[model samples]
Target: MPNSLRPSSRAAASSARSASLADVAALAGVSTGTVSRAMSKPEMISEATRVRVMEAADRLGYVVNGAARALAMRRTKTIGAVVPRFGSSSFPAMIQALEATLAEQGYTLLLSAPEGRREKEPDILRAMLERGVDAVALLGTDQPPAVLSMLAAHRTPYVQMWAPPGSGSDAVGFDEHAAGAQVVAHLAALGHKRIGFVGGRSKDSERARHRFEGLALALARHDMALDERAIIETEYGFAEGFTAMQEILGRRTPVTAMVFGTDYLAAGALAALDQGGIAVPQALSVASFNDNDFAAYLHPPLTTVRLPIREIGEAAGRLLLARLGGEHFEPPPMHVELIVRRSTGPA
Candidate 1:
């Protein structure tokens, strides 16, 4: 029988032996090294030839051994990122940007979250290290000492995202304190004398602490004071913001405006005000940091600080690639802008 009529020969060979690079090379009419290059470093190979090799490998059910490849290349071509929480607030946008940038350069991303527990970050990072990730990106510079020491011991190249300039570490982010001061300035300009703040726990979030500090500084500048009772520290969640707002209202403090550390929290506060029949920008004005996607769609539109989240993520990815490429340079600090919407007015 003709070879086309009878698949016995090819089927018998495929069944008898596990496919190897040489087998794929033979089927694609390429050399073994070319086949290897096509799989590991496809950029160096022409597209047509790469397609031929891939098709031959698929037909033979050939699977590249990542362990073997790593051993040979001394790289897994994978990058890892550790954040406080995934799918929370603005992190999803940052992660998407990071993933897209890395994919363009033939790298994969491995993400991890500490589930709001800073103490667990070190263990999570150690696990990523053990998995042979090429490099790592941390969310902020406020990492546990153990985590910093571990990264130092491993000599891993890392960059911190959402951190300020001159943070004494490789980072790509904006200044949270300045962002907070901007909000206060806006409120003060609107004739708001009494402003309350709803935010997350200062101990768990450096960003929140800086924002609160900035608020206090700006309040003093405006000859105003933040009522100790008006400042509520809660978790970084919508429910937490709602409850904090409710508690502040219960205190009956003469707060004409509210500044939230994040837009997510501000959103919750808005919900509470709506439910309590409080007219925003009339009875009270609201401002927040982080102009997340939902901010513009909120009732009355949220007035917030517009952080370059996606740009920061993309910059972080580029920094990692530069390190891998043996290029070194300090990145400039990103800037934040104030977005005035319907949420804030004369108070």
Candidate 2:
């Protein structure tokens, strides 16, 4: 057939379908491999070829197929993250920091919506792994065996956030148990004898369980105990905190102070206390964890444990980046301070 009988190169590049690497290579007068190198590792190709391929790609409105690129490179440059739930304040804050830190290193964050059920974690993580994520970021230190096994089978690099320093994976967090102990010690030092605890479910939440344990032990040290009648374990929510506080009040346990697992819960409990005509620190001292910005902004200004949340997130991201780079990076130690505010006082 005559050259005129064949489709023109420009017309072929402008086909209705999305332009492919072949079209770009053809338009740039280069090979498909050269186009790949020019798009991915431009340094590997000549500047002239790289610019020509880029211009052709631009003209064709060609978008790099991430999946195909990952297939060729064996890395997606994305880190998958799955947390217990998004209902809490701290995780979201930590995630934001993690995303920003990862962005600094040019890694996209791929999040799994909810690791609500422990049993569902395997599926969630599996979906993430199947997407060719370079690494994973989990909320807790311990994972169900299936999840761990799957990760191992795939040889995926993973790190845990807000977890104790163990479990055979890179982890970044302050000691949850210590945070609890600090909170109790602060309240007890203020002469709070009868302290009630409101927290997320301990059965599935490792952090909650650790905090509960710390509170119990610290209360023991102070000659008090975690009173069952006054303790309420609920989901991570403001309304839940409010309801839990009301329930604690109904228990008739006569507590002088209340400790919440997180600032979100503390906020709700404060609302409940205010609505119930109880004065903070004056009537009942209230303290909690995660010194979120709102903690200082609350009416009574919560007395809580100030976690290095964003720093922890940045550290976690750095740990993963180090792992990817095959460099040695320690999970830096983070401290949690007992921020004494007007929310707590003499009992």
- Evaluated with lDDT, which candidate comes out highest? 1
* Model 1: CA > 4 A from native: 1-12, 15-19, 58-61
Tens digits of per-residue lDDT for model 1 on 129-168? 9998888999888988998898889888888988876776
Q: Would you estimate the TM-scores of all the predictions?
A: 0.90, 0.84
Which is the leading candidate under TM-score? 1
User: What would the per-residue lDDT of candidate 2 be over residues 310-347, giving only the tens digit for each residue?
Assistant: 88788889999998999988876788899898998898
How many clashes show up in model 1?
0
Q: lDDT of all predictions, in order shown?
A: 0.84, 0.83
Ten consecutive residues with minimal summed lDDT in candidate 1? 1-10
Candidate 2 accuracy as TM-score: 0.84
Q: What is the C-alpha RMSD of each candidate to the true structure, in Å?
A: 3.1, 5.0
Score residue 172 of candidate 2 by CA lDDT.
Answer: 83
Model 1's alpha-carbon lDDT is 0.84
